[model samples]
Target: MSSPVSVFTPEESRAIKQSWKALTADGLLPVGLLLFERFFADVPQVRHMFSGTGIHGDENSPKENFSMETLRENDKFTKHAEGVAAKLSCLVDNLDNTPAVMNICSELGQAHKMYNVKPEYFDRLGGVLLDVLQAAMDVGLDHPTIQAWKKAYEVIAGATKPYL
Candidate 1:
């Protein structure tokens, strides 16, 4: 149940912990919403996948009618977004526990696979996430923090890819 080696250096771990704390200080829901907004805007091709998620107004409505308010008001969508944020928090909390991190990421991978999420989408989303994190940071996501996040993402994706 244990990974053979740790994935993060001490400095990287500290950077990640500090930045994540700042990033989620307000709450996961807002961070989740911001992530979705960026994801939907940056990856329009993924819109169809969210059609049934009530993010695009309603189940039968066109995506062009999408609104932040619609997503905010939709309990299901909000919960889904919250779930995403929660999972990231789990990973961050378990940073020192490689097995837990692997298991978490693996479960995420399996779930996304069931959703028919493409492998490439993970890579694309990772980039968008970094951008969102950087922009969201008022104190600035410094070099070490960025590198830490990138490496953590690589580990997450690596573990997640097998199930995908």
Candidate 2:
């Protein structure tokens, strides 16, 4: 079977690199936190997982174990998000390095699978994250930027397909 990485085009790869530069130049770490807050808000049960708690099947918890304060200015959360962004930036920088990129994608996919994250959840998270990036870049949905993000997400989704 063709790997998910096969879906990306050269142009798409370039766009991802440009977008990553834009995001980091504008402080993506904080913006990432905001994006994740909204993304997990919809999946309340997932909050604990990000908080270092293992995922539990039940979804009826009334109170979230972690608060925004726990995430804000938290070194661990900051480091984690920064690591993810860094990995993503590396993927963009080495877009032509298919082997390395594919490996990272596969690892991410497996991690998501362990978290029981669904494809739809990824879709939603992607949308929100892109929105955060767009706002951070202070650019509307320009064609090139959006296309790059689309390609990036496609690659990630493809990587995560095994887990899903």
Candidate 3:
């Protein structure tokens, strides 16, 4: 199906690609995890829903086990978070492939809908991510880069809006 959102402008796409590359080069996988950390920090109750498994802290610790109970209780939020992370990673990796990017965005949006993820959460996620990026880079996002990131995410969000 055709995407509901317009394709990103060439400049926006380049900016996003550069940012993703810079992030990965800096040793962060899926930069979205930074946002997830912030999101969970703000919503502590959501942490209980997440099995500590597949998530790591700065210090060494045994992996927390996953359980169906956690899934059943917070499946929507957890699944959407996981899906968004995966989709963003895929987009970064397949940067040259428009179809792949669109597919990931569509699937991400659909997953969010199934998980009942709120639209407002997307904005929060983007905001937290930008904050994380700035901190990680030790500098604020330049205007052009910020605009590109916002534009790219907006396209992703708009494409996925139908599923939500």
Highest TM-score: give the candidate number: 1
Best by lDDT: 1
Candidate 3 worst ten-residue window by lDDT: 62-71
lDDT of 1 by residue, 25-121 (tens): 9999998888888888888777677666745445667775576677788888899888898989898888877888999988999988877898888
lDDT of 1 at 103: 93
Error of 3 at 108 (Å): 1.2
RMSD of each: 2.9, 5.1, 7.7
Could you tell me the lDDT of residue 102 within candidate 1? 95
Give lDDT: candidate 1, residue 22: 90
Runs off by more than 4 Å, candidate 3: 1-6, 26-32, 43-84, 93-100
Candidate 2 residue lDDT tens string, 72-144? 6567776776666666676677676677777877887787776677777777777776777677677777767
Error of 2 at 154 (Å): 1.3
Task: For candidate 2, list the clashing residue pairs, or say none.
Answer: none
Which residues of candidate 1, in runs, are more than 4 Å off? 1-5, 54-61, 138-142
